[model samples]
Target: MRRVTAIVPALLAALMLVVVPAVNARADLLGGKMTLRDENKMGHDFDQILRAQQNMVGDTYITDYVAEVVARVVTGKRPMPFHVKSAVIANPLINAFAIPGGYIYIFTGLIQSVDTESQLAGVIAHELAHVSQRHVVSRIEKQKKVTLLSTAGMLAGLLLGIAAGGGNAAQAGQALVIGSQGAATAAMLHYSQDDEREADHVGLNSLVAAGYNPEGMPQTFEIMLKNKWYDNSSSMPSYLSTHPGTAERITYLNDRIARMPKEFLERKDDNTRLKRVQALIRSRMSPANTALAYWDDMKQSDYTPMDWVGRGITLERLKRLDEAQTAFEKALSLAKDDPLVVREAGIFYFKSGQADRALGLLQKASIMNKDDAMALFYLARLQAEAKQYGEAARNMRKVNELVPEDWEVHHHLGMILGESGDVFGGNLHLAYAAVYSMRLDKAREYLKRANELAQTQEQKDQVRELEDAIQARAQIGK
Candidate 1:
């Protein structure tokens, strides 16, 4: 096919390499650039491996939230790579992992249990340390000597379990455990305690250097210590289960905090951000819980814009739309021209079927902050629904350019193009739309030409399934 052929073989070859470790002569860990032999061994690219694994784990919201806060704290100070993707898994364990690249995943349970953002920062910083120090690759190298075949076997086993709904495995070839995928994840947890401690120590310094409160380290450790005692298991909470001992580490952190300058102990943020995060969580809670948290924030006697925003969100979620509107408007009144407040109101209006109102508010907010891609995208969605097709397409195109990987936008654009009657161009976009959607029939239709498309076997398999399903649906229609 008239695909990007020059790079396609290497791309396809890369996909095959990482599909499973058995294809490889050596399971070379990620660190430097991939060698041809290493490439041959895995049969797929390492990047694909990481991406597949991330998709397997799903949302890691706590990680994202913590990373956002830390990013704010360390902004302009550290030369950390711009994190391209972040996710928070729904898992309630205390574990966090970062791939060789900038992908970081944090478990929700970890956030629910943490006492402070700094503590969370410590965890994130530690994971960032892993990425920065190339420790994941280092561990991979260390594992190679311990027994490569068994390691690959174990990793493979664990991954199979995860894929089949068995559990989490840190590495590729571990012995497969039956039942919950938790077992495999628990296995990876074993090697990283010392690494975790080192990360905590180093991460604390990183946090302080970045001007976050270093006291968050020891304070969080203390909370973990209490949880440790409260737990009946020999293993620490799932967070610490993978990491090494925390008691000595807590003491060490306390000693460091005691001896260090008093400034680190007294650090704080706008608090609005933290409270907003808390509020966001509360807003998603059950109605009873939402009411409780909202009242807790209000009755606390310490009022803040975030509290108002939080209560508004909870009320909105509770379907008390008018009350929600009032709360958000009050927040706006308190803080005139706040983009966050305006954005929230715009979202409420948009979701409430008031497309014009939502568009008006969002457009004004975007003008106030022209770089708000989300605001622009939402406005575009409303416009599209309202049959303002040309405007919607333009906005969609803009957002697509800004966030090329967002498949939904591409899909929308493709549908618009198809309906607009530029059949060939539309088909080309539709092919991309199918690939992004992992739709088989559409991919097959688009890939009918002898194109050297670089798709992993799994992706190819998904396309085939989609094609079959599409055919079945069409038959039913006929």
Candidate 2:
């Protein structure tokens, strides 16, 4: 599937080596306390694994919003061992995890599950605190002689529905042991009681410092604790099990919240941004009919402009075109300036063959939200259909810049470049499209064709870069 960018979902095709890492990489590691440089390499390699294996949400709107929250928490804090970055996993398991490299993965399930932005920030702050304290590093250093399951393995065990063997590191089936353990990892690296308590303590301070309500921390904990039993999924237990003293944690958190100043505890969360992003995730990521029903069941009083957009998207997915059009129109009537509503509605009209309307709206939407890769994408395609290949290529290049690794974007860009008569550029992009899409044979073929077509040094350089990428990607068990 295309990455669910704004409205499109892109699958990373096992860029998710984060969970079960490569055996060779595992062997390369020294069994001692890791230096900051070693930790950096470990995080980089594992990040590739995570990206490669998991279906990531590439929507700039959703991801950027979360990253901002992470930034808010980490900013002005103690200097970290590594730079902090964030990614969204496409799973519906109400989970988050941070690897050694300050890499935090937030699950769509957790986003969907949160009641407010504060609650989400609360959870994120806790994860950040783990990195700040270097808990993972300390644990590993202290336990080198133990036969216990590695913290990562324990997390993988919980995340992948494997057994969490206390001392049985032997059950870690694969040498690379990382993939499905996202939540377990986020119990902040399978922490001890002291570590867990410290995370809560440090995280709450950061959460309030970031201008969020103190209660959000305990509320999220309450949600997680309850969810442990409500979710029947075998994989979810690993997420909850790692946080052994949830009741005590919640009690302490609530006690802490009670002691905080009333102003901090009672702060309001606008939730407008959160709601809009949630609407997108619900409508785009859920089953078509299910999503439609979810929107349909909402009371009229609770409906926002984005809720209508959600309804429209789900309706469109179900091929209920007339109703979807009405829903979109209703959303536009309510909030015409909302970029999400405008962009989604514009795409709907484009798909419905209302080219003139789509052209105006998408053109406006792209300008309104320049970071929206998908809007630029459809704009390019719409312009291409009008035989305005120049406009198409220009807009498509913007899309390419916004989503450099998206194969579909590259494919369309390649097509537009070809149509615009830039054969070398076109073929180079096609080679890239093939490389990202994991079609090695096609990648090699396009590289050869592009190499033959290269007439400039820059063109030759592009070919060489893509060739190198293909060679690396072709490595077995990577």
lDDT tens readout by residue for model 1, 298-389: 55356566567667777776788897778777777786577656766787788777777788788887678665556677777777777777
**Residue 407 in candidate 2 has what lDDT?**
73
Model 2 lDDT vs. the true structure?
A: 0.71
* Lowest lDDT 10-residue stretch of candidate 2: 6-15
Prediction 1 TM-score vs. true: 0.67
State the lDDT of candidate 2 residue by residue for 1-478, as single tens digits. Answer: 2433221111111112232222213332346655677556656656554454346776778888888888877863556667898888766666776766688878787888889999999888887787778776665445333222354443344333222212233234322333333333223234578878998999999888878888888888888877777745512423454455878988999988888888997799988888888998888877677787787788957888888889988888889999999999999999899888899999899989999999989998999999988788889999999989999998988877866766777898888888889888888888887777567899899899999998888988888898888886665234
User: Where is model 1 more than 4 Å wrong at Cα?
Assistant: 1-95, 107-117, 145-188, 224-237, 285-293, 300-303, 419-478
Per-residue error (Å), model 1, residue 252: 2.0
Question: What TM-score number comes out for model 2?
Answer: 0.82
